[model samples]
Target chain A: MAHLLEVKNLRTYFHTEAGLVKAVDGVSFHLDEREIIGVVGESGCGKSVSQLSMLQLIPTPPGEIVSGEVLFEEANLLDYRQNSPQLRAIRGGKIGFIFQEPMTSLNPVLTVTRQITEVLELHLKMEKHAAQSRALELLKLVGIPDAARRMNDYPHQFSGGMRQRVMIAMALSCNPKVLIADEPTTAVDVTIQAQLLEVMKEMVERFRSSLVIVTHNLGLVARYVQRIYVMYAGRVVESGTVKEIFGDRRHPYTIGLLKSVPRLDQTKSERLVPIEGLPPNQMNMPPNCAFLPRCPYRIARCEREAWPILRPAGGKHFVACHVDVDVKERARETARS
Target chain B: MQYYYWLGGICRGNLGRSLVYKEDVSALIGKRLPVTVHLGLVSLFISVSLGITAGIVSAVTRGSFLDQLITLLANVGVAIPTFWLGIMGIYFFGLKLGWLPIWGYTSPFQNFWLSTRQLVMPAVCLAVVPLAMMTRQSRSSMLEVIRQDYIRTARSKGLKERAVIMRHALKNALILIITLIGLQVASLFSGSVLVETVFNIPGVGRLLVNAVFSKDFVVVQACVLVVAALVAVVNLATDIAYGWLDPRMRQG
Candidate 1:
């Protein structure tokens, strides 16, 4: 079967007074039907930009999707002429989006029912009574207790977790085929994050919709997502199943990322490894490996050669580095010790 | 002793006798208040509606040629003095085109059509600055609101551009717009002084200006106090509106 969504060579650039900032440069990925995928990266690593580019939601003045094809349900969204009606029909109708900071994502002035029913009325063509009932059901579905009473309340009246749930309910109102959640739990506490993740898992499974979780939290992705894509300097540095990524990670940056996070399985005394140097300045990104400066395993060849491109490294795992697989594994093993 | 007597009279709603009109202060205000109120309401209504619409358009189409054009016009409109605009309006519409009555007051209750016709030029003249201010404020407010994450969520929900702007963007921008309009009430009344004088209307603005020139302290004092009260009332209304409009404010 065809993939649920396919993004190819997506390059989203921001034109500023200084120069063109390649926010999402030459990145590519695909999502399977009902599959949960996580795009993991630090802030400004183009993780959010990459997902937003799929829906063409980036603000245009300084930002533009320069080149790419975003294929949803076999339709190319990147086509210039497909802007208004076609894209609008596909956007919330087929693919829903939940942004970071639910405090700011839900309209503060609008009642929860109004916000949810707007999507139902617009896309589902539900009447007022039916829409209101459906909105109440959505609120309940996302685990908002006493959903009927809460419908009349505005966003500001809800707690942060509750607001995030409301946002999720709004996203799921039209029964979208895919839901792109951008750092959905970053604004909430860890306990709330666990609950939200569980709610998301259950809801996505029940809805039978593919979920694309965009976040910097490696631990969260490791525990939740079936497949993962590690992004760096606007490119997919590594892509693999969760097991392959966690067990046999090849890319140095991915290794650094995994090492930086504290694992419960690890001994209490293991010091968290921090990646040295900052992510490269996007405006003047070097032609060679963008992560060369911060890469612990980077060799002279890495600096001499152009940035390595992703190549399948057997069994659903892909790595974008010049180093030999055996040598990289040996280095990783030594670092682990 | 004299001040206490004067204050006691004011407290009882007796604003004292008008020196120029030689009428009861209360009666003078009662008769003149309606004209200013009439002019103020019509001009405020027009300026707010038109200015807000222009501002929304300016913000939604920001950086477009149309946005730039509206912004430029708004700036120029704000800079143009009301008295000068009023004279130019009189020359072009009243004298040259024979379109309107250049100087006079007509009550809507007396003759609705003629009152509307008489009001058109003066109201437009009075509206220019506030309209410009409203447009500028709403534009910036709308631009700020549109940048908000909720607006993106609204658009991502497949809402039409109109729905995204009206339901999401405009509603958020309204609090700022309301505050601006509230602040403008003072200027609107003071602005009418020049506007009424240029048009020779019998509003309180004209009454106040005439009273000032004639050194009628009673009339001047009454008008100033009334204008201040109007400003205070408008501010209270704006605060109430903010509470009504924003739940976050309501909670606090």
Candidate 2:
């Protein structure tokens, strides 16, 4: 099947006071129809920049998508030199975005109904009365109570969870083909996160849209996405199916991420292992693999050379590491024994 | 109930008679009120347009030469006294150049062009304070509003740069701008006294000045009351406008 979206050699840089910050350096990924792909990365790992760059959302003068080809259905979005009318038509209509902060993402002055219906009117070309009616339907779909009456209420009147649902409803208003959820659950509580995730999952299935979930929660992605892309310091170091990632992770960063989580299946006596050292600053990344400074199994070769190229390990799983595969496998075996 | 009583008295034309003019206070207000409104409205329109446009330009190109120039002009405008500015305008445009007539309000119906010509210097003088103030306030407010998350969201939604600033940022900044306008209205009335005296325009500012000099207690009280009432109405309108611009204000 043809890829729904393919971002190739994407480089996003921020021209700041210090120096040129390569936030997303030589990143590439793909999304298929009706498939949920997890982009797991710690903060400042370029996951958010990759998503923002794809949508041409980075602020110019300071930030820019210097090089990229964000191909949607084989059409190059980056080829549009400016904010052409065609690009505007594609944004809220054919491509939707759910931002991290629901409180800030929404216009505080506007009503939930007004926010939802605006896209419907602008993109769908629906009349006011028709758009309003559909807005109520959307509010109901997102599980907001008294959809008709609540339509007139402003965003401040709604709770955090409800506001997030409103944002989701607005994103889904025009029924876009792809939904880019950038840390959608990070702002909410754990219980609300679960509920919101369920709502998002159900909505994705109902709409049959491709989902690119950018998050740090490996556990949440494990349950929601079929494929996983583990990113570190602006590079996707590993890509594989959820089973390959969780069952037999290849990259040390991915393994560290998995081990850091407190799994229910693990014995209560086993303490969670945190990833050591801070994530590298984009402006001053080392010459070798970015995670080398922190990797427990780092060898002399890892320090002396640039990062290894991404190579297929087996059966669609890929890893970017110079470690001896057989030795790591034996070590895993010995540790298990 | 107090407002209603005041409203009834105002409607009954019982604002009391002026001591100096010895005319009904309401009649004096009716005669001079239109002039103040005309001056205030024109000055406000000029200031808001000039200020907001300059502000947006300054914000978009924050550290550029044009931004620095506008900042300097705004600073100069704020520091220079309105009365001093009015005297200089009269000296240069009215006296030295003799390009414009210095005083008196002409009936536009009798001679529209001449009436506007007469109004030019005084109106521009009356506008100086508001123009300077609105520019600074609007620039700061627009700067803050543009930094908001919704502005970024709007841009990410693929809205044009102009649309993002005008529709999203400008609308959010309007409540504060309108409040500035309200506060400036009271000061503008006070400044008009100096302007009218300098230009010799027979507006209420001159009338109030004359009343004060003559110790016409009734006229002084009546003029003060009328100015106070106008200020109150303008503030109330601004408060109502806040609710209109931001529905969140209505709930809170």
Candidate 3:
């Protein structure tokens, strides 16, 4: 069966004064219906840009989707012009986007009701009264207490978590087929993160809409997502079923990310092991392997070969690297020493 | 005391008689108020509309040819004195082209076309600085607002580009625009003094100027009082509008 959404060889560039920035370079991924996936990366890894490109939402002139095919529901979204009627209808109507900064994402002068009802009115062709009633219901679904009264209030009246809940409500207002939450919990307090994630999962399941959580936090993705794609230097270096990725992770970048995250399962006090090298600059990226400078297990051939494509290392697990480090041999050598 | 005597007359709704016009100060003001008000309103309408449109265009199509043109015009607008522009306007539009009257006022009620023709040069002169200031103020303000996160959110909702600009960006940018407009009202009337004299129009500014020259204390004080009152009313309206536009301002 065909996938619900598939991205083929996406490349988004920013023509800055300094030079061109290949923000999302030759990245490809897929999402099945009702599935939850996470796109993990550090800042500037192009996780957010890739999703924005899918909707053609990036600011033009400075940002340009150089080349890409965004296949959704058997239609190539990129084939539609940025301001075309079809793309406009599909964006907020069929697919909802939840941005990172909920605090500022909402129009401050407008009431929460207006923000939510606007989407419904534009896409669903609902009357003002009808859209408002639906907005109240969506607010309650997203776990906003006193949804009725808060609907009339401005964004500033609410706390950070409450505002985020409103954002979730707005995104799921139309019962979208796919919901993209771009770092939805980063701005909130840590205690609210778990609660917010749970509420998000429940809402996604309730709407029967597939969720794509774009975040840099590995731990958040590990707990919430069914599959995870580790992006490095604007490329998906590793992807697999959650278990395969965390258990038999082949990419050095992925391993570095996992180690950097402070896990709760630690019994003894251990220092956090952060990845040593700085991320590669987009303007001056090395032609061969972008990760060559940072890869601890890089072989002599890694510098000579061009960046490798995703090759199956195991069932449902793929790794993009020229050489594979022997896991058993490393463990044996460590033990003997 | 002169103060108490003058205050007592005001309490009785009597502004005393105009020594020069030899009419009740109230009656003199009533006759002349309409012309001044008409000029003010028309000039304000032209300035605000052109200024805001230019600003929105400048901000939206930033660094474009049209934006550059507006910026250049706005810069020139601030530099040219209203009196100098009026003289130049009279030379070109009045004396040279005979397109409009160089001086005097006609009630629109009497002859609409003649009144419009008579009002053009003076109105344009009065509107210049405000239009210039308004353009600069709103351009920067709109530039800031359109870059805001909420504007992005509005676009993400798939609004047509124009709808996003008008509905989302415009309202947010309006508060600063309103404040600038309020500040401009004082300048508008103050500048009108020069414009009315240059055009020889029978406006309140001309009445007050003539009174000051002839040493008519009663008319001078009343004109100042009326202008101050108008400014006060405009400021009050702006504050109320500010509170209404932003709910955050309304709360304690």
Identify the candidate with maximal TM-score.
1
lDDT of 1 by residue, A247-280 (tens): 8888988888988988889988779989899978
> What is the Å distance of residue A292 in model 1 from its true position?
0.3
Q: Fnat of candidate 2, please? A: 0.47
Best candidate, DockQ: 1
Residue pairs clashing in model 1 are none
Per-residue C-alpha lDDT of model 3 across residues B105-215, encoded as one tens digit per residue: 999989999999999889989999999989998899999998898888888888888988998889889988999888888888889889999999998999999999999
- lDDT string for model 1 (B145-191, tens) is 99999999998999988899888888789988998999777888988
TM-scores of chain A across candidates? 0.97, 0.96, 0.97
Error of 3 at B217 (Å): 7.2
Query: What proportion of the true contacts does each candidate reproduce?
Result: 0.88, 0.47, 0.65
List the candidate 3 regions with Cα displacement exceeding 4 Å.
Answer: A323-337, B1-34, B109-113, B208-226
- Model 2 clash pairs are none
- Interface RMSD, all candidates in order, equals 1.0, 1.9, 0.9
Question: Higher-TM-score candidate among 1 and 3?
Answer: 1
Chain B structural similarity (TM-score) per candidate: 0.97, 0.90, 0.96
The lDDT for every candidate, in the order shown, is: 0.90, 0.84, 0.90
Docking class of 3: medium
Tens-digit lDDT string for candidate 2 (A1-337):
7789999989999999999898998898899989999999899999998998887777776888889798996689998755777777778788888889988888776677877777788788999999999989988998998877888898888888898999889888889899989999999898999888888889989998888899999997689899999998888999999988888788889888988988889998889989999988788777789998888888889989998878898886899998854478668769988
lDDT of 3 at A236: 96
Expressed as tens digits, the lDDT of each residue in B1-252 for candidate 2 is: 965765577688686666666788778867887887777677777877888788778887788999999988988887878778777877888899999887778767788899889888788878877888888898898888877877766666656678777767788888668889889888889988888787777777888899889987667766788889888999998899988998777754
Docking class of 2: acceptable
